[model samples]
Target: MNGLSRLPRLYVDPTLVPTAQKGAPCLLTPEQARYLGTVLRKKVGEQVRVFHAGMGEWLASIAEIRKDRGGLVLERPLRAPQPCPPLPLAFALLKRDATDLVLRMGTELGVSEFLPLVTERTNTHRINPERLHAIAVEAAEQCERLDIPTIAQVQTLPALLGNWPHQTSLFAAIERLDKRENTLHLPTRQVQEGDGLLIGPEGGLSDNECQTLLKRPFVVPVSLGSLVLRADTAVVAGLALLGNGLRSAPVSSQ
Candidate 1:
């Protein structure tokens, strides 16, 4: 039973298993079934962990496996569902590969929601939500996360700022700040749970876009240091700094 933890974990839809208990049948998607049977060569009675964002995780054994379909029998519960507050990371959409990287790494860093923004300089306003969602799911599984992040539909920069909730602080990473504007440097204090981090696309936000963000009371401009970083790099660095703050702060404060 201890070795069951080492088995591959798959994210199952919560709706697929409304009730979970020992010996309950858990169906697998065609892709998951094929991956287990063909790729991993796992046979009936072999163990695997199945999880869901709202239903928690369970250790189960392969009940049956064929070319395109399979099922599992739950052995026991591994963890109970415990959802966290939104860890929103709103970033300008970059190239396909960069955007995928941001979603993957962002999931690993505990981001619970992703808001893709289209700014004046953003290369494109389009994205395949299905593909991006899969990337985040894989990252969550690899990182042993209990939940997957939700990828919001693409939205414009001004629209996001205008509609953002007033209670949540959005840390905007602004580059090339003047010495007198040093107050805009990243804050040293711990960030609250609902707080979010925003990253601009490569070439950074335009002058007009920057001014718009500055005017928003919810937007707090922060410097990611003097050296200019690639868009994807900035997302990772900013999240790391903010995540550190969240981890260090007292639980009651968060």
Candidate 2:
């Protein structure tokens, strides 16, 4: 995985590639192969982009093919793609349709990871990891992205904020600082470049959750708009805004 930055290209793997890297043979998983062969219709010697987490993105070329299994030749390196903009989205689970929509959008939006928070008022925290991974993989392939974002098991709201990572925390509270201007440049106002966000459940956050957030120095509460946003809408809207924040900031120094 440490070599990820040097290998952001497409690959064909017979066995699962635990980590993709320069000069490494990234075997496509059966699911990945099915998509490349049946859905994508890619053949041998076809060029593709592949990546491993934290290694950033890279490009690869197919060398051979055997049904839906094959080998890949790591080609010249692509310009170092930035480590996925340090944006993490934590939101409560929505109903079935809405939850699936959020999963799809979160991948496309480049969310680093998802923590499905179970709040006291959460209607259901039901989620299938396999199905969610399918959604994320399909979204990445369709979006022409090099990497697959991670999805963690659903966690309780209290447990999520209790031991916050030592970084900036942006709670996309439905009733906090309003407007895009508030979200813009918030990273500068808070901790550092790494920004994590949390959106409320459909019914919105309970008084205890909001108060718990307010007391944290790392947590800077912000709003998406004046009108109430559905759980899915808030996730997309917040990601779009936060993504823009990462794009506008000056490139980080290593």
Candidate 3:
């Protein structure tokens, strides 16, 4: 078989909770068993690629297949674990579907972390971290990324700003660019590691909130364009621009 036609890739726990090793049978969870047996219909000798968030990716072979039970014998390592760039996105909480879209697309775009914030104009503070986490995992699996972005708990804008790290740079998306004298223009420098992007609620940040954010030396107000954009649209556009910038910047040792 050609190299491209090899086994399917899957994410699994690396600890081998059931105890898996080279030449040893590694038990597959019931969900995994159904996926391989019923969904993929793989035979006993079929190859599979498995990876863990903590451990690296591996090449394994199907040892057995059954409706309720299945196993894959570990073979060799495929790739080593790599660290994701520290590009964190802090967005004000939106409605359910929009919020999910941000997490899904952000993961695909290589965002390292997600911070759900509650702003002055935010409509809701209720967020399900578990659901968002699942979305991130699915996105990473589809995008073939070795690491999943960390999803943080929902925090108020003030609380988020209060504990903001010292070294990280913050880019705040604002609506009224005409008001600010020092607005960040596009094609500005590339975003390095430890940089953050912040998007406001649907109606945008309040006057008082904007003032508060502007007072911080670390925060930089950024404009999307002349036309108004929806909260979700702004996220995709902003990440695309920032992702491109990150790709252009020279790799840093730190």
**Best by the lDDT measure:** 1
Q: Go through the candidates in order and give each one's C-alpha lDDT.
A: 0.87, 0.69, 0.81
- Predicted candidate 1 versus true structure: per-residue lDDT over 59-157, tens digit per residue: 989999999999999889888986656789999999999999999999999898999999989988899999999999899888878898999999998
Model 3, 179-237: lDDT tens digits are 76444543343477778899999998998888788778777677799888889888888
Q: For candidate 1, report its TM-score.
A: 0.94
- In model 1, the Cα lDDT at residue 88 comes to 96
Q: What lDDT would candidate 1 get against the real structure?
A: 0.87
Tell me the alpha-carbon RMSD of every candidate: 2.2, 6.0, 3.0
Please provide, for model 2 over 1-254, each residue's C-alpha lDDT reduced to its tens digit, 9 standing for 90 to 100: 34543322342222445444566666666656666677777787777766544444556776665556666655545545454555677888888788889889988888878788898779997888888877776676566565676788889976877766855666556564543233444443432356877888888888777767666767777777788888788888878777777677676579
| Candidate 1 segments exceeding 4 Å error | 179-189
What lDDT score goes with residue 171 in model 3? 83
Candidate 3 global CA lDDT score: 0.81
Report how far residue 168 has shifted in candidate 3, in Å: 1.2
